[model samples]
Target: MQKNSQEKDEKLLEKRFAELSRTAFQRDIITYTDFLNLNEQNILHTLPKDTLYTRVVSFGGYELAERQMAAFIPDALYLRWGKSSDPLDYTEYPFSAVRIAPLNRKFAEELTHRDYLGAILNLGIERCKTGDILTDREGAVVFLHRDMAGLVMDELTRVRHTSVKAELLSAGLIDYSPEYEEVRGTVASVRLDTLLALGFSSSRSRLTGLIEGGKVYVNGRLITSNGYQPEEGDVISVRGMGKFRYQETGGKTRKNRISVVLRRYV
Candidate 1:
């Protein structure tokens, strides 16, 4: 049931991709899509290599963003500089930041990513229409499409009883790094299940179910093997769990086990 629905969604996405590229080529202009997750991006990457319609690129309104928008570039726009090698030089992504600041710092609650997203969804806005929501000490910065920035700014006033003020920031100006807590543990090996168990402090037996159930992704690519090993600096995302970064920072322990570190998202 769910598998069939997912297949249908992927097919629909492929069709949408072709249509956007066709429109961009026919009109000789750029066509864009709302924000896409890593799985959706993988679908786009699986499309045919040679496309006559347009070239595709993506940006999430700022650096170090996970959710992003895709732009289909026609030849006229892609080759404006005459055979330029860099895609970033030719394209201007249609995304901007909305700085959601608290009305009163003293009274503001410690907001979270879920809180901001919940407030945004409460505005009747679809999740696909928005990019990543970066949250921190002062407030959150939602990567919103240019079309609905005004609505978010005007209506998204209160998050969990804390009044917030929104301001539109210039695109491509904000720098973001996700917050994480350093966790160190000794694993028997750097296998996928072992690393995940270390990160979540779960038994490998249960973690194996997650890996085999298509719930684990390393650097945005799905991994299904319990024995699959992850490299250093690999970002792992577990559906319904949390994100983790794997790092092998030390040599073998005194017990001859591997010393590993996992940066768990806080």
Candidate 2:
């Protein structure tokens, strides 16, 4: 059943890819991915190198962060595409930022990523339609498809109890600071459970249940075995939890346990 399902998904993805490629070829415009992770990324990367779209596709998010929602575009088409007569700068990227500032800054509670996403989603926007919602102490800069910029800025008014006014941020107004803290820590093993427990501050037993329940993913593939060992530089996504990276193995401990470093995206 698993094998059959995998094959079916692959076929569906292939169909979608062909459709997008055809659309781009006929329209001569850049296209973007609705949503994609490591598994879909793997499939995309493995696409036949000889295809015309293969060499032209590029991925980016306006800011540097963990597990960014990547886009795929035709290189030539994007070079010519622009907002005005001036060609769009690749560094500027195709994403638009919707800055949400509170009406009363002092009384405004600091919103979480979930809060921001929830509010945007509450506006009837699908999760796949948007990229990442980067929040800071003062406000958040939401990366979204350029086409939806106007709609989000107009429709999104408040988050929770705090009234907010949204505006489309120019490239100069964006604050591209590091969104997460680099948590350097050691783990007893490279097993999914141990690393996840430390990353999430959860107990090993809870992590075990989560992993066995098919809630853990390594490199975008579902992992059910808690004992599954992950190599360095692997992206792990825990549904309803968060995403983290198994950076590397530092060294062995005095107790004969493995030491490792991890990046937990906050």
How does each model score on TM-score?
0.84, 0.70
Best by lDDT: 1
Off by over 4 Å in 1: 24-29, 48-55, 73-88, 253-256
Model 1 accuracy (lDDT, Cα): 0.84
lDDT of each: 0.84, 0.70
**Across residues 104-203, which tens digit of lDDT does each residue of candidate 2 receive?**
9988987898898898889888776676677777788887767777888888888998999898877666657554556666677678889998888889
| Model 1 poorest ten-residue lDDT run | 81-90
Clashing pairs in 1: none
How many clashes would you count in candidate 1? 0
Q: Where does model 2 exceed 4 Å of error?
A: 1-14, 22-29, 37-93, 172-175, 179-188, 203-205, 219-229
